[model samples]
Target: MVKHGEEGLGFEIVKAVLNGDIIEPITFQKVKDYCSTSGIQATETHMRVILSNSTKNSHSPTYKNYFERVGKGEYRILSEHRRQEKYFWLNVDATSYEWSFSDLKVGRSQIYSNTNPNGAKRKKETCFKYIQIGDSVVAYETGTTKAITTICIVENKYELDDEIFIEFKKSVDYDLYLALESLKANGDLKDCDILKNHRGTLFELEKKHFDIIRRMLRTLNASGDNEQDLHEKVKQSLADGSDERRARLAKRDSVTPVSYETIVRVFKRNPDVIAEVLMRANGICEECLKPAPFYRKFDGTPYLEVHHRIRLADGGDDTVANTIALCPNCHREMHYG
Candidate 1:
């Protein structure tokens, strides 16, 4: 029964990842949040138990692997209402990356297959194969002629084993393409380097990029005039903080009398206070009442977050009444938003 429950939780996590709602760079707290918002009635303990056991089950791959598979153009989880075989095209300006039957044909045929013995298939059999300039095919894998591509292509062909290796580009959604293009136009492409490198590490970075693009699409889809302004505001907020402010605030408040130096000393002695405070806050999430469990103190404790109801910079008193317990998600919202 326990195993079954864990499996259910694992499935939920996978579902969240596929939906692009899990928040990138899977963390325990993030997973917890996913569970909460997903309306799954599982506790963090249940989540941890299932996740830990799932990790050991051999059937379940690491969270990193899940994102890599999704990001590396290997697999996708389209909405159920969408047609299965039909491809989605992502258009940016004049260039469009699409997941058509032709693209899949190229990817499927370029590599050796059990049915084809010539080591070289006919051109028409690979109707989607096309050659692009200036890139080398690094690797190729075999699959059915129907697999989808989710990433975009930089070039069309790559050199491999002294042969002209054909490169099949990953397909992108229109919104993602425009987002990348916008970043490139603004010299912010480096912010999306992980997505470029196929590293799947973008999960660790702030979700501001993803959120911006998503919001832009939402606005445009709704024909809202404030889309650009909303995008800029979101971008500015993501750039202003490191993930360490919550910790620093916790340390500052841990002192016997709550002096800066004493807070530092207390934090040095007991780093867990941060997590303690957050736990005490019942994981209710200080901001928006959503589950946000990812937080730490300067000392790297896992609980007890320190929150200032009134901003010190705003001339709010530092008294306990003016302070309240908050989770890391709330702490960040307070600082960033």
Candidate 2:
């Protein structure tokens, strides 16, 4: 415990500075004024010494972390609690909007045409103004919100006489055409209320719920992509393909005719394992603690290859606990180092 005289003096001074103002971020002069009679004497050096002593003691209750330096010599009383920035999840009805998830499929444009509700096409009943750019959009089946079908990011909104035209930057649920039924098969859908009721609505969602959606979509899409890539690679290696590289490889072969054989093996890769490890690493190689060497050509996500700490060929299960994100150099080092 600190002694009660000069040793404990700065605590009172800090308290005065904190409670002195109606609002926080008070001027340093106000702090000094409020703290004038708390201690022995008032001089330029004494004031600096008290503040310096108080802030320097980080373990002390009157530490500088309790306050923030906003302006020159001005401090703000900072609250102890902090939270992430809020983002909203919006609900859009397929029946009301005259839209479908099919419109967001591969190679489709980013525009979505939403029709105005009957008798709601006037200048006064403009609730469509509630939606803004950068909000999330979720789709439900035509008549009910019992299930969420798709998700998209708002890009632009244009209002016309009988309809509202909304554009999306990209959709997380591109390949999903009415996914609610499948979701119901996995989990109970009766608990969703906001998802069932609103049209042109923006309701804030918890981070956990948002992550639930993101994880499902991210893993699903990545698995599909990896499967496609594997197929395309096999197809390119086959000499019968239309690709020029296959023909060139065939021509470059020696006089002993080589036979082509197709061997299909199941690639049991866990999408969630790779996705979670990469996200946790945040594009830095786990082995080197450096940023990835390059970005992916398709998406701008930093290219850190996922590796298994225990070799999969050695009977390791595909799981995040057994996986890591590493740059190409570190990955090669792991195998051949």
Candidate 3:
């Protein structure tokens, strides 16, 4: 807390100067200029004390973490509450826009077609008007391949006579693209403007939606040999089917050469063991106590599988004492569920 006697015109000056500049570092002279413009009287030392103290600095006297010193005579606002990073989705149609993902990677500003040139000039319903520098942006390829292919940070943005242009910094293109179906399955991005209203070129993405897509991209692009990587790949493969990859596969022969197989060695159980287990169940599942779904076509007997209380692979004997009859549903649940 700023002590009762500590907060003066300098405290107000600091607050006014650092109101909205969260990412960029501001110099001491900038703070001084703000104070002068606002008609607040404060010395340089007083301004420094408040700016340095904001809890992020370990040596700060005040119990606050509002500001962080970035460089010599420069500071930026500290997101004390761990604020979520702002994210935007840009729809890039190569058919209409001359600039491509390559242009963004080379630090060229992207220009989108503007329907109302006068509206952009007047800042009325303009797409890029509210986008500030340092915001995260995901570029989605539209028209043909519907996937998010590039991620970048907004370096600068402006509205021209008939178009809105925005520069990107640290733009990156991942090997994997996040398809629309994959994103929708991962999060509630279907509600976003890009899907709900496709006419718009730029749309604000919710933090949750952004987090989901970013995580999937990072996990897919992660380089390592781990169990989790395999699981993520399986999940991603289930969710996505790339047109190019599918086309390549379609050309190849459907049946490929058989390779080595994994066969589990098992003990040959006595026929009487299964007979005894089935006889004990009396046409009912031992687990769920439900009757068998149907009778066998050949024998007219209840359909059931003899399940060992302890799996045969786990060293259980092939005795009736260690076996029970289960319907197909219960048998599948025992193995998978």
Candidate 4:
């Protein structure tokens, strides 16, 4: 058992571990290093004392009690508030811990319509033409009635009753409630266009309501953008095999093989044949039909080496019927394999 004075050192070690400086399965040398840095002048005996105390208190029996073992050790710091669950673990030199754990609450207030039971109600029915569901409204007590809360819609129409109901997706704080009361009493509700100008206020509403309004605005403004339709058309064409079918059936039938030396000789002797072949193949490799075969030698100099279909060693003659141009890989694979 470690003495009470040594418990202070143990506390410092715990602090270091929690601060992400020291880790579990910590070696004596590592603890010594931490003590040196922390100005504790710790010894192997002091480390053993602390380890014994920690192990005695540790809930897990498999956990190593002392540093005599050479292999790595694992230890956990159990939360007093939560006995069954370990909050953090110290592995070697890396300690992992949860930052925070707290419950979050989210709720909204209910919308209510205020109407007088004794007083005669307005004869005209409220005709809300431009009123939207997400529109913000002000609620306040009408006249000198301090207790009765009055809800003000965007407009006070002849058809609308004096009492209006505004739906709130979130519980408003005291500051917002006061502001709404001020706006309602000032006759801002008569100006329906003013609600449209208060978009910045609506955007500051609860995240759920803001997202709903933003999506509604997008749906209202979605027009004249056919780029997505054009993309779908191209995607359908590729998926339907039209692009691949056209590329496969293309005129890859007439390419002929001619060596780099033969090409130079032919260019000198019959420039017309070289030009005709280039025009027919459209300046592409006859084997792969890829444009501009700039083959280079080991010295980095471009040397186009034309291949023959039938090698002279195999009793193959030099005729267009048995000749085909090939890249180096295709040429080597043909000869070797």
Candidate 5:
């Protein structure tokens, strides 16, 4: 019987090179030995081809020089992230994963996953950093079908790779396997290998498949959940959710028109105050300290305008102390500018 591993032979070679700390380029023997111990069945000639083909002519299709050739028949893996096949799903099973990730409650939790294959781990602690915020997670219930479980919200504000927080919504149903079955039955999931029983803590799925899974999850609600309950919850949690709170913040920033009338009391000017202040100007604009620009058409005086030092709208008294004669330019500035 042939032993099997999910990653193919070439990938294992890269893993071996990464596992090594030696300064010298990885030789054929090191990869061959790693493969043999790891249950990788391949011919010595096959290993030669794997090495030679990885560096030669750059196939750009299969195991291309995504690796660096250091010396004759010696190479190092480059673009390790690209070398690993990107998965369409991310596994979130903390119990089996031994608290690899905490369940999100009220919208935040730190996410972490085991770094395997010895190579990728050295590059980064875990595959957890590969997942960005807003990326969907397929959380399996602890000690169960290794299936979908609950909805956990990733906070918009998270410390990169270290302090990720997720909040679990109140919709407490965990029968995501049924939803999975529905997806498979409707030609949704079975065609995709990402939905299968993949080992390791973070099973990845494609964006499209993840979107479908999220849509399926949306249709499910917790026991005794209702629209009224959800409405109140959303209202209450608005201050609590970063996503919704950000939306509200944006809404607040956006221009909004409000209509109302204020009943501010008007102070009857003493008329004497206006006369005295205007006289004090003496054919000059008191504010601009320049002679009046033009004579008033009606009064034929220096045309300096009588104005309030402080606007009545601001609760300033209608007294000479609060008045300043100004030219039309300065008057307009006082009123509008």
Candidate 6:
């Protein structure tokens, strides 16, 4: 029996080289060059399998239905027969496993078929075969955070030593973490496959639902705030009593350290304002009338922070009239309490 691996492999290679315009035909020589550079072994006969003429030479019906020969060694994908781009919800147990998302971000994650028993092995095989280039995947951390952590575009799929591996290119960073509850709350995703079942590691997500999720993530995580505004937002998130505390309590022992990239603003304050406020208050806190927490090691000056009556970002002046010196405890209470 013909392995038909060439047909599958050729189809993916052609798909990757397809231009968005689709008006231009892809030449066999171009495909060959790509295969040569990409380390894909292919013969002229296997290359012909990517065209419609291959149907007469081989029993493989896969690519035969999609590609049509427009000229000698030139092919154009059948516009009407092209497969639609697929969307997937892939569950990654990043909380339980270290460095999973980091590896996934670099397109090095493996889809292990031998990790589980019969049913899981079958599912892994199906997912490996089903996912193709141009597909979009939303990776969800299901072990602990229960949030959609990253969005990825499927770039390549191949088998090595009988094990399947997928290469993914991260399209967008869902750093804010679209929580499971937030997804469940969306009306369009309420009946989504993963939400309804939540059984397997991979599930087909509807394009409409995927679009909604993408839009929601991009909108919620949009940045352009002043440092004070950003700080206030962080405070608000911490003060949110909906489910944060409960979730933290449940994962007290299972908690693992994870790092995320974020853009933060560091305020550049007027030094004269701090010096004048400290001079006016001496070594006492303006708020609590208490002594400074300690003396600075370098200059032996009392350690105190100048508190702004109204934040500078909120139109407060950077002068002694608008600032006051406070000890560490009083400053902490002024900001946190």
- By lDDT, who's the top model here? 6
Candidate 5, residues 1-337, lDDT tens digits: the string is: 1242356666656554433311124567766666667777878876676566353546333335445666566765565433333333445555544542223333435444334334244222244434333344556443443446554433221222333222222223332232344555546666677555555555446756766676666554333334335334433543354454445444553222221211111233333444556567878888779999887564365766667676553455555567798898998666445
lDDT of 1 by residue, 1-337 (tens): 1332355665656555434354323355667666665556776665555344242333335333432222221222223411222111222111112223222422232222112234554333221222222212212111221111233332333223323333334333321112323334433335754335432101222345444444443443453434434334423433434344344545674333332221011112122333334444555655456554554443333332456575443345544445656666665555544
Order of quality (lDDT): 6, 3, 2, 5, 1, 4
lDDT of 2 by residue, 279-314 (tens): 679879999999999986755678888788876534
TM-score of each: 0.21, 0.31, 0.40, 0.21, 0.30, 0.45
Worst 10 residues of 2 by lDDT: 256-265
Per-candidate clashes, comma-separated: 19, 0, 3, 6, 20, 0
Give the lDDT of residue 105 in candidate 4.
13
Model 4 ranges off by over 4 Å: 1-7, 18-20, 41-44, 52-231, 234-337
Better of 4 and 5 by TM-score: 5
Quickly count the clashes in candidate 2: 0
RMSD of each: 25.8, 19.2, 19.4, 31.5, 21.6, 15.8
Q: What is the lDDT of candidate 6?
A: 0.59
lDDT of 1 at 29: 64
Higher-lDDT candidate of 3 and 5: 3
22-116 in candidate 3: lDDT tens per residue? 22344556666666766666677766666653435564544144555665555555444233457788877766655556334435456443343
Could you give me the TM-score of model 2 versus the true structure?
0.31
The TM-score, computed over Cα atoms with residue i paired to residue i, of candidate 3 is 0.40
lDDT of each: 0.36, 0.50, 0.58, 0.34, 0.49, 0.59
Worst 10 residues of 4 by lDDT: 85-94
